[model samples]
Target: MPTLYHAPFSRSTSILALIEELGVADRIDLREVGVARPDGSGGADARNPHPEGKVPYLTHGADHVRERGAIIAYLTDMFPEAGLGRPVGHPQRGAFLSWLFYYQGVMEPVLVLDRAGLEHPILQATFRDRDAVFARLSEALEAGPYLLGAEYSAVDLLLSSPFQWLPDAMPRQPKLQAWIARCAARPALVAVTERERAGLVA
Candidate 1:
């Protein structure tokens, strides 16, 4: 069984939603752990195995996966029957991998910096700005409802998460807003929301 260290209302919540999507919630060992929030409320848990004590950390036997994109890839590959992953031979495999890495390498940093109101030519050159990132997403979403087109995948779960959490920050573009709504309407996300509201999750 895989052990997932999760913190409710945090980025780990996305992993919980993913697990629900993969239909492997019962198979995973979920252990709620404390995480230091941006508001400085929670503290790190000694039991969390993540080196950084981060939520969304997973350990299965000898292997441990960290980061949202990596964990999504890991779990989706582990359960390919869920059809959330594009296997190696699939035509969309490259695009799938690109979206995953893009969330980590680009989108996350840009969102964080933009939230902090930090902007400079150097930062813009590196990760571009929030508008540029959204433009890329908007261009892709214009083709279909999801990032990969005609199918909702892990990348959709990942890229749409930030906006779901901070709806005010979401772009007002029609396609982008519609995409967010589509992802938000997933039954899995509904369950996660209920669990959080019930305080059943940490």
Candidate 2:
């Protein structure tokens, strides 16, 4: 059985939603591994099996996987029946790979900088400026509901998770708001959020 080491309200939520979206919820065992105990103890323990002690670590048989992006890529490959990923020979495969990597590589760092209230030196910044990043994202999302047009991919799961935090951290962009609304309307995402919320309440 594939096991997912996850906490209720962390990046793990995205993985949970992805699993649910792929209809592989039964195939993956979901385990809650708290970052800290109720009495304030540290460490995730043997069950979680992550050196960094982070939530959403995954183990498939003998293979141990950490990091959000790696986990998504692994699951997509593992369950090809889910069709959340582009096949190896498909024309869109490169675009899919680019977007998949972009979620962690570009979007995450940009968000971290935005939240930290730091400004990048104009000449040295890879993305030109914050406005440029938003403009690119807005144009990508404005075309339709999903990053790859109508088809919802694991890339959407990756992108949507961070974007969920955007409105509070960055200046509200209209296109992003609509994009978020579309993502939030997905039944799997709704289920994940509700499950996490109920867990928190309990």
Candidate 3:
């Protein structure tokens, strides 16, 4: 069985949601392993395979996978029957890859910098602005349902994760809000949410 080194409420939470979306919870062994314990005695889990002690890294026998976006692409393609992945020749292939890469290449940095209220001219030029990121998402989601036009792909699982965006600010855009609700409504998310909660306490 593949084992997922997970930390509740971390960036890896999206992978937890993805496994739920794929309906493969039983197939993956999940171990909560990030963040300091409430007692403050625990820090940077010794079991974490990630050099940075990050959550959501996957270990499958001798193989290990890190990073949220790569994990999504790996697992979805591994189980294409779940329909969360756009496999090789699928017409939507290019867009699927683009959306997944955009999460790290653009959105992640924008979220961090904007939250910290720090900026540099080079970052602005390279990553563009948060507005540009939101505009792209808004335009895509304005079309409704999912980023990939009606199909709820793994891209939805990544992009719609509320953890990355602020709670109060997300509601300002109706389309984005609806998209979030749609993602939140998935049975996979519900199950993952429950699992995450249980794991945190355990």
| lDDT winner | 1
lDDT digits (tens) for residues 84-108 of candidate 3: 9999999988889899999888987
Candidate 2: where are CA atoms >4 Å away?
A: 36-46, 122-124, 127-129, 200-202
How good is model 1 by TM-score?
0.97
- How do the residues 158-192 of candidate 1 rate in per-residue lDDT, one tens digit apiece? 99999988877899788888899999999999899
Off by over 4 Å in 1: none
Candidate 2: C-alpha RMSD after superposition: 3.2
Model 2 vs. true fold: TM: 0.86
Error of 2 at 35 (Å): 1.5
Clashing pairs in 1: 8-202
Q: In model 3, which runs have C-alpha deviations exceeding 4 angstroms?
A: 36-42, 163-165, 169-171, 198-202
Report clashes for each candidate as comma-separated counts: 1, 0, 0
TM-scores for all predictions: 0.97, 0.86, 0.89
Pairs of residues clashing in candidate 3: none
The digit string of per-residue lDDT tens for model 2 on 37-154 reads: 4447665666667887887799888989887888888888778788897777877778788887776777777777776777858532763455766777777876667888777888
Judge candidate 3 at residue 130 and give its lDDT.
75
Query: All predictions: root-mean-square deviation over Cα?
Result: 1.1, 3.2, 2.6
